[model samples]
Target: MSGNSAERAGELEVVLVKAGRTKIRYRSELLLDDGNHVAVRAPWAGEGVRDFGFVRFEPGDVFTEHYWRDRWYAVKEVRAGDGTLKGWYCDVTRPAVRDGAELVVEDLDLDLWRSADGTEVLRLDEDEFAESGLAERDPEGATAAVAALDELEKQARAEGGLTALLA
Candidate 1:
């Protein structure tokens, strides 16, 4: 179904899981479909001391995740329970798949994070991604993943940045 229809119907449920554990799940009221990318926002599920690269969540967090069908990267904006913006977390992953009730991403173990104001960029988990054997198995994909992180960082510093892209 098109994103507009999914948004109007309020039936788009996205579940994000990694390594057999669910990281987050939410029902989205608006889904943006821009040919190759889809974006959705909702309050994060559960409560924990969740850590992005440059920030941490106490108990509650709301997030907007933007997924690209062709790119191996997804950008997520983290916010506090009170709706205070925190930062951006970008995940290098396999292209997302959208099923009837879910959207799945196979995270590639590499991530990028920047503070709320586009300062302090961190590239995280490089060792993990290397140890995961993804590079040996798919060298081209690994290269693309790194390139995606670079491009994401560039976007984070752009005039409109991710917020405009999501909007």
Candidate 2:
């Protein structure tokens, strides 16, 4: 699978480790080799920038257990940076609402897409998010952040950090 990844075109192969049933995290290496296959160039390069004919991850995203692997993502026409291509990260999660500084919210349901030039554009469900007044958080990041914060607070209290602060 990594062999064909555009992110692995001129560099190390993209390797994905399983995080859970829903998603697998992969580290994609990018190296610009114009004469070869993946033609990733710097963003500064103007019109000559490589053109991405198809965006695989953005549209037909499918999760599967392939080659006896746990779970994998199949993105077609995937391009990486330096090849003047952008990458996308897509997911759906809980929503965030803000009340005060106590709640530092972020977007949660952020489906990300990258152009060949490395511009990350988000894929969002407008109607769903708008209904929640998610001005402070996206469904993905905000939800994850809050959950992590909760854990942090718990650990801090366990370590007596909160009590120390009061002193």
How would you encode candidate 1's per-residue C-alpha lDDT over 115-157 as one tens digit per residue? 8887677888899987888778889988998898788777777
Determine which window of 10 residues in candidate 2 has minimal summed lDDT. 64-73
| TM-score (C-alpha, index-matched) for candidate 2 | 0.23
Name the candidate that leads on lDDT.
1
Candidate 1: how many backbone clashes?
0
**Which residues of candidate 1, in runs, are more than 4 Å off?**
1-9, 15-30, 51-53, 158-160, 164-167
Best by TM-score: 1
lDDT of 2 at 109: 31
After superposition, the stretches of candidate 2 with alpha carbons farther than 4 Å from their true spots are 1-86, 92-109, 130-142, 145-167
TM-score per prediction, in order, is: 0.79, 0.23
> 82 in model 2: Cα distance from truth in Å?
17
